[model samples]
Target: MVIELYTYPVGFIFTFFSILSLFRLKISLTIKFGIVGNILYCLSILTSIPMMYYFTRDTPLLLLLLSRISLLIINLIYLHKLRLKKREITLEDESEIRKTILNLGTKFMRLEVREISEKCGFDRDSIIGVLKKMIINEEIYADFFQTTNTVSFDQQTNIDEIDRLMTVYKDWEKDHYEKET
Candidate 1:
């Protein structure tokens, strides 16, 4: 197969411009138009391939235009779904953290601290301090393996002890709030 020197490079230039337009366009309508423009520009690359195959054939310009239009429509729908999925996952993560905090009676799990911070929008240092205090007070017991830097909480913590710990946390939150006001 013979290679055309200009075909791929021209296609690549159009592709780069299309990507820039997709990011730079602000208004939704303008963005949609930009996406369509990008698709049409990319479709030109595909036409170049067919142009090589049938050197003498008159390629239908309308067909290339239609293909680009269809591709743009498909991509818009896909982006909408992706945005919805991201929102749903965020809600689910928040719900999960709330449930875990309630059931565990304190946000002191070594393994889950990072996730808790993300879910609750807390700083890492604050989470570490809370966990450290819980460990120091014997409110929760965690076994740390120094060699592996791994820690696991005791699964057999008594319900009564957890209830008492949660009550203390609730009282502390009330006092903290009052102080802030």
Candidate 2:
């Protein structure tokens, strides 16, 4: 009974951290937290197995095992996704994505994220990540539509400002390259 009672609280604490980790901006931290949570969860499930079988005789052992197994599988899938996302976005990739979005934003007021992803040769997640960073940095004025997976650029955004920023950015890149070589 004691083990059964403590199992939930411990699991809940780790699970909370795992879920909270998703909100973290850094993917590395999220993955670390998720891994810890999974390990703790596995231990909890193993420890609780005897109590579960003994205390709750009405519940079939197979059913309990299957349920726990499914939960573990789900956690494994989540970790897999985290690993995929751990692929860091390089500076060159960021710059290319930024340039593509800016160029497209100039031509159209709104565009599907899929369209931008295809044009830039980056995955949808990468495009979304850059778009979010740009939005946060005040480099772009836009709103995301979840239903359609599209971004609508605000009319108030100055096209001239976009052009100026791009020009200055390209100049800096050119100078930096020249210095390096």
Candidate 3:
């Protein structure tokens, strides 16, 4: 009788902390480790329900229902927050990919797309997609040849474009500076 009295609250507290800890370790589970990380996270959440319910069964019906319902609600809210964080993390990843492509694109006069894909640990299509976006955004000075499956960089052209952009920026700054002040 004495042990049973303490077990419910103790177990509930443990499960609560377990869930909270999982939420705290968001980056390691959801972003860095990928699918396996997600699986472990979901399992921790799913397992917590049964653990809480088992402890609550001998208590009043109201307490049991409240514990289960509250746990589910908390899980839902945390999942929603995790989804938002995942979106932010994904955007950061795309930016990193863009930077990597720019660095690789500059290292050679002409390089194979497959080679960059291998170095970046992403698929060939993903690499091509990032490269296309970079080209569209004028973030890289390169010609992407889909027919030949290669990218060719011209540093001189890039330098000229940079100089032109600087001149345009300076003119814009001069025009806007006086008005804003």
lDDT of 2: 0.76
**Position 62, candidate 1: lDDT:** 48
Reference-based lDDT, residue 38, model 1: 54
User: Which of the two, 1 or 3, has more TM-score?
Assistant: 3
Worst 10 residues of 3 by lDDT: 30-39
- Each candidate: how many clashes? 0, 0, 0
Q: How well does each candidate superpose onto the true structure, as a TM-score?
A: 0.30, 0.47, 0.38
Candidate-wise lDDT, in order: 0.56, 0.76, 0.64
User: How would you encode candidate 3's per-residue C-alpha lDDT over 113-140 as one tens digit per residue?
Assistant: 8888677666566667778778888788
Q: Which clashing pairs does model 1 show?
A: none
- Top candidate on lDDT is 2
> Model 1, which residues run further than 4 Å from truth?
1-11, 14-59, 90-92, 95-181
Q: State in Å the error of residue 37, model 2.
A: 26
- Please rank every candidate by TM-score, starting with the best: 2, 3, 1
Give the number of colliding residue pairs in candidate 2.
0
Error of 3 at 38 (Å): 31
